[model samples]
Target: MVAGEPFRMLVDPLATGHCDQWLDLPETSRAGDAAALLDLLFGTDDTLDLVVLRVGTVRHGTASRRLLRGGAKGIDDAAGQTLPGHPRYELIDWRCPVCQTLVWRIHADPRRPPECPEGCGPMGMRRTG
Candidate 1:
């Protein structure tokens, strides 16, 4: 170890809350709809964080906070819904970064990490996008 050359602290996967898990959905439905998809795919595997990563590009980036309403309804509703609606499940909303466009849909398996559809790179075992 050289003296003060440089020391980049490594972030442990567990410590950083990375390497999360989630159940992708066919569409970007309401929170409720998304949850149902999770239940179906994971079957009670709630140990992982559900991150809606960027699927494609958009003219403007919306905010997650704004998407949610009462008691985190938009986010929590997924726990009690079946499928999402049109606007809610639109690809424009689920933009894919690599493709530089919104994805038609994405349904990741809970048991496995998802791969990049555009093939720009692998969806590494990290939590955050």
Candidate 2:
């Protein structure tokens, strides 16, 4: 590198910029259709054992196979919960699959999973640092 010398790094705007197809824009963040949302909210339509435990026992009642759609607000509320020492729970906003409505809030706890507001089932989670 020389003093006052111009250096350039080749970068593809579409691949590196905000316009990247893989980058989910704010407007296009929602799942393409309700079916996808349902899949995300609940694992699958098929019945299976789903559980969240504090130690070795179930924390909340098991969610029976059902469909829940509507009251996006309720779902949002269910998503956010307060912990003793942790920072305020942050959730990704999403559109309800059953209702196609905006959800301002939603979260999932590793120790205690969130119940489906519309009775869809239980919300899944991913570990965040």
Q: Among these predicted structures, which one has the highest lDDT?
A: 1
Across 1-129, the per-residue lDDT of candidate 2 in tens digits comes to 221111001111122212100111122222221122332334432442221101122111222223222222223333223222234323444333443322223233233443334445544433321
lDDT of 1 at 102: 27
* Candidate 2 local Cα displacement, residue 48, angstroms: 4.0
Off by over 4 Å in 2: 1-45, 49-58, 67-73, 76-129
- lDDT of all predictions, in order shown? 0.31, 0.26
TM-score of 1: 0.27
TM-score of 2: 0.18
Model 1 lDDT tens row, 27-106: 22333444444333333333323333221221111212122221333334344354433233322123334544222234
